[model samples]
Target chain A: MNLWRLPRLRAGALAVWRRNILVWRKLFVPALLMNFGEPVLYLLGLGFGLGHFVGDMSGMPYLAFLASGIIASSAMTTASFEGMYSVFTRMVPQKTYEAILATPLEVDDILAGEMLWCATKSLFSGIAILAVATLLGVVAGWQALWVLPVVFLIGLCFAGPAMIMSSLASNYDFFNYYFVLVITPMFILCGVFYPISTLPAVAQGAVQLLPLTHAVMLTRSLVAGAELTQPVLHITVLAVYAAISYYIAVILVRRKLLV
Target chain B: MWFPPDWPGLSHSNFNRHAITFYNAGSMDTVENEVMAADAPTIRARGLCKQFADRKAVDGIDFDVYPGKCFGFVGPNGAGKTTTLRMAMGLTPLSGGTLTVFGQSIADHASAVRRRVGIVPQADNLDPDFSVEENLYIYASFFALPRAQVEARIDALLAFMSLGDRRRAKTTTLSGGMQRRLTIARALINAPELIVLDEPTTGLDPQARHVIWGRLNELKSRGKTLLLTTHYMEEAERLCDELIIMDHGRILAQGPPRELIERHVEPEVIEVRGEEGAALQELVASSGCRQERMDTSLYCYSRDAAPLIESLKGLHGLKFVHRPTGLEDVFLRLTGRELRDQ
Candidate 1:
């Protein structure tokens, strides 16, 4: 009934962010290894093994084309997982949100802090993937560094939806549906492994509606040092998803935490 | 609305307004010295209620908690004690009526009121991933206390709670009692004016319970206002300056513990057990005393027990013990002896 209740950003958010950082600092080693290790295996297994036959796509080697897409997609997966699994654990099993709410921090503070933390985590994973791809000669010129900030924005975009899911989740089992129905479809159809242009016209049109498609397209242009046309349009699409999802996520989290 | 003047991030003018208002409201010296004169109530609720669907979790209830006094809410499970506490702490919204903390409405100024209060929840929801010190540090950050200021109190608080040796251990590694103590310690990190505790010693052993009670008494003696809920009648009698007995989301009686017992039940009680109770009860039927029967025991209440004991001499097979009536007798008399559970 009170859908027009406006949400404001406050200072207590940093406290929640600091709490997560303190805990994450203790477990960063294994976390970093997974973030870096997974993309490396995918790049080797799919890019090299599958690229032998595909050769080149649109005047670039298949491995190079695939590497940029992985950078964008990896950030998506990392942020989504952090927002869903980790946020759920903190909210439900651990009761971290309950403890924080007892203090001066409001529901809005916890929501903003959680989203920022997930985005920060996504940035970490994306950077590691980029470094590995560069060492393997899949990256183009220094212009590829521009992909870092774009990867962070992709993380924020996915984190918003994943957090909305966390707010509605009753148990961990519900997350499997999200992965199978939402994440898997995007991973396959958003041009991560191959160009979506090869799919049917209807499928390609549907792919453009997905947030991952814009992330992949923008990252590919930046990583390949290609002069991109309508670059603002691509960035705006990702930014719009991030902003709208963030607004909805905040509303959902407020309802869940403040009864 | 009253945010603590020292908490970080408040605008300079807002801090000045809070300081001047609270000074006029007489909450500025909340914990520093004994309040010799009459003080204003730290919390007030008038017709406060909370509804979930068709059920009333906390039906219209009223109470006042004065500064430097300990107020206790004693009730059985599902009696709306926790719901009322949650509302007072701004963890949940009020369904109807007015509730205020430090003279400011909770519904209108929850965030500001929350900044000036502390809470120890019934459950030990400490961060299991952090060490004891880290738990304290993270909680202090919620109040926006400077790292240096929080650091200054860490050692003192840990030692005061007898958690000094376990400061470096993960919270999950601590025993149940230790974790509860740590939770209490965490609540005091902000030096709050009003501390709300929900069943602070519900599951502790006798020794641990006494230790926590001793610490709570110390906090009270230092002039900190305390509002707590407990199922233990003895705890309410020993610690509360004033207490309320609640049932079915309503207040049954409200007054000092001793006064309530004195006003509700007789001065003395004789509990008789075994099959001979009915026989003994018949003999005292003409003694002008009152009796109530439980499943296996008969409780006799009288102003004088000497004549009652004399009347029971011939009924030699029954076991009986006489003692002064306590808050438990008053509570049972007010709320009835029925089990209150879903």
Candidate 2:
């Protein structure tokens, strides 16, 4: 492919973003109340209410620590929601990919467009949760600004592999196994609500293998204004995963669309 | 004014004024007319072929589609008609040969070629998410047309397809015929020079098919090129300037429908449906008409059918009808009755 094709890819990406915005506008209010409300309720009930006995966690306020974890987890959730559900439906049930391929656009354009759309959704969802966390006085300093971009990167990282899975999935029932076996375990073991060190040494090592673990760790470090030393390592790990996953997604899309 | 020798109105002038005016007018007319008359073929294909694994779908075929002509591809199922059309539009890769639209190869200039061609697929692939008018607008946007121009074209195409009243209705809400019409309107949004329809009226009722044919004819009158694939012989007869009959990935025949029928089938055909196998054969042989017998029917080919009918009158359990030969007869004569599983 020529480097000059970047403009076309960018245009396609923008088009997908516009389509996502349309879908969001139609389903936004209900989705926001559910996604935002559930986490906030968790914060109020578990963070504040339980903090009276548990006190500070890992030398930080329980609410702040918990808030950062929620932001990271929700970023993954948002990207996965769009990538696994909406993207899968469009690829299979809706047959949208078949229609798009009939145009002058190619498979690479479709993959880039979909990945960008997933990233945008994750970014918005992450920001919404972050703002709520601020109202509760959990965030600190300018590091919060970095949270947005990192969340976007994290969302993109998951989106690439998730899209590949979506393309391969045979039916909606297959997604159930994916969520139950892969996603649920990652959420529990990735230090989303508690420190991973509390788990057994083997379990802690297993958590490190997950992309979400690096994302949650990096996001928590940034939101709480902690030292930046280990955050760089986390960012590197996430970036590697994202690049590899994206390449796989592009290949799968090409095979499916062109063939 | 002084009288001049053999000069009427120009007698008073030193120069012949009409000659100068005529010369200048004729020169300008020729210059303007030359450019307009030089328009070339809008689509051309040479030795185009497509193969799938072990089988060839479309094999080395060549043709030129002049502007404003309704070109038809007539073939039975699995004859490579759709595959050929798809290759022409760059929707499918060509296994061999080349196709050019507006004098440019599709491989080298896809975007430019696609901008001038619109396609209606055999299956309905309408965007179920958008309303009727929105579907047109979004498709136009892919061509990067201006928003104002897109909206204007959407309105015009909707009115042209008689879907103005249902512009805002979701695609799922529309009837099958309505959806097909909307798909046609969508194809016209960019003012394509050539429109390719793959089985456009396959499942439509007779009334709807006629309506679609009317729309296609209207487009033809406006000087738009149409390339369509259909199994309906009557449609090809009614709409096409010329067509090709294909089978087993090869062109069996190509010409005007009537000419193909005349060339391949006799002037009249006597169809015999009965159990009098030996008697029917004897009648055909004695009547001097060439005959072919299938499992259920006997076809007797001749210029005059009355003699064949009279010869067959004594055959027991014989029922027959005589009719003028048609494209169907030509098709049956060439391809036979073997079923092709696509």
Candidate 3:
């Protein structure tokens, strides 16, 4: 990339990151702690406590399996929170996007900056959760390092769709329908807590269509030191979905903000 | 022509020296004979129009905003003043005709045109997440100014707008007037050649409005051009070097304030307040002056008001007063008294 274009995108992204960090600093410390602490409590309370009952499933420790699933889930959750909730509020309620666009920054710069910011936040939260899981003896080997890139891919996939949903959503109430119908089903039925193969054949086929299921399977297999087979297929499917969702999001934001 | 002889007050040497000086001054004048031409106008609009569905928000309108002049657009609500101004800044697309800023078409070179113009929208659009200084610095960054230059400009603007004390305050914490001033300050971050204001003093108090007017005059002294849309007649009269009175998306009249009032209205106006009946109409018909009826008041326009007032003195239940006609009377006459569907 040309040096001039790089700074344009980098400056826009850094400005957004700095602004969000300032806001996060002003939020109550307890609120910030709770947001980071919830998943750790889940890891211990569910991964270890529940693993005691179902030990050594799928030839891997139950705690290890659950830890991988938590990392993928954390990536999606953090990206979704930033891409959907915060972006929507800034677009409609706060009118922050209007204020920014009034400057010389183009729509492409703003969208790219926002996506990068969401990815950064999700990556930070994912690594923190992964580090905590390692200390708890849940992650097994150096193979866990692969989870970082996988979590980043998951964040990108979720961010694209979340941005589109945010642009279409008219009010906070409209988000409830999306949360109940799309997000909740993906979390529960996509094998976050159990293997998809354990479910019926029909359920397994249905879970295969979801982005989260592919992410969870990839993260879990990588963390368990399992042999990699046809991994390119998983990566290809995610890349295609992310590309199409991003195209749609960019068009929608341009129509909504620029017009 | 023969030169006149020296007068008693001057000696012959003095006369000769004065003649030589005059001849040298005339020769230097020919050497520097090129006239200082006026700078080109900053904004030129011709037949600009905008339509929303079936309603024409801006009809065909033509005007020019010159450099270093405070140009005012005055009209009642829904007069297309803001629509026209937005089109000039390339914020809103024109339905028809051409608008050029700094000699470039708004359609073909919108970003380039926007680079030379600053806008203060009718409503405050400050970023809530950033502090006052951050808001200004971010705007400067949009123009791709260097970090050091942006910081210097931010400091200068903050002090100029009297906002140094509120540099760290969030936008939501500022008062209405403070926010308005901050918006103006943000517009100046880029140091644009032309600054467009859309009803900048709509809700400000008298004191705040005066402060803004004073700053605008200072900007004018520094050779900055201003295009403002306002409904306050007094504001138009006070600050505008030249003005356009618009109604129904068309220019009703345009000139200096005094010239516009002189052309469109009379030098003096006698206002009569009474119920309109046969007697009032008969009195007005026989008054022998240019007259217009608005609601319950009859405005008789003339260079002299005493004759009209003397004729109405004996009328019953009538209150009459004489005052100078102004831009408001011109606007009401051109746009009429009917409420517009804004």
True contacts kept of 1: 0.85
Q: Which parts of model 2 have CA positions greater than 4 angstroms off?
A: A1-8, A44-54, A141-143, A197-209, A230-240, B1-41, B274-278, B293-295, B310-319
DockQ order, best first, reads 1, 2, 3
lDDT of 2 by residue, B1-342 (tens): 221223211221223343344345567666434322343456778888888888999888987676778888988898899888877876666788878888788776765677787888888788777888877766665666789988888888888899989989999999889999998888888888899999999999998899999999999999889999999988998899778888877889877787888789889998887556665566688888878877888888998888777777766667888899888888888888777677
TM-score of each candidate? 0.92, 0.85, 0.84
Clashing pairs in 1: none
Question: How much is A174 displaced in model 2, in angstroms?
Answer: 3.2
Docking class of 1: medium
By summed lDDT, the worst window of 10 consecutive residues in model 2 chain A runs over A1-10
Runs in model 3 with CA error above 4 Å?
A1-14, A28-31, B1-39, B273-282, B312-318
Q: For each candidate, C-alpha RMSD in Å?
A: 6.6, 9.4, 9.2
Residues forming the 10-long window of minimal summed lDDT in candidate 1 chain B:
B31-40
Fraction of native contacts under 8 Å reproduced by each candidate: 0.85, 0.09, 0.25
Residue B229 accuracy (lDDT) in model 1: 99
Per-candidate TM-score, chain A: 0.95, 0.90, 0.88
Highest TM-score among the candidates is held by which one?
Answer: 1
Question: CA lDDT of each candidate?
Answer: 0.85, 0.78, 0.77
Tens-digit lDDT track for model 3 on B1-342?
224323324433455455555556556544222111222357878889898776888889988776778999999898888888767866556789988788778775666676677888888888887899978876776677788888888889889889999999998999888999999999988888898899989999999998898888898889899999999998898889888888878888887888778777778888887667787678777777788877778888887778667767777767888898988888787778776676
Could you give candidate 2's per-residue lDDT for residues A1-259 as a string of tens digits? 2222322444655555565566577777897787678778878898899876778887889888888888888888788778889888878777766666555655566677788888887888787778788888888877788999999889888888788788778877777877788788888889887889899999988888898989988888888765555777788887888777767776665555443
Best-to-worst ranking by TM-score: 1, 2, 3
Rank by lDDT, highest first: 1, 2, 3
Docking class of 2: acceptable
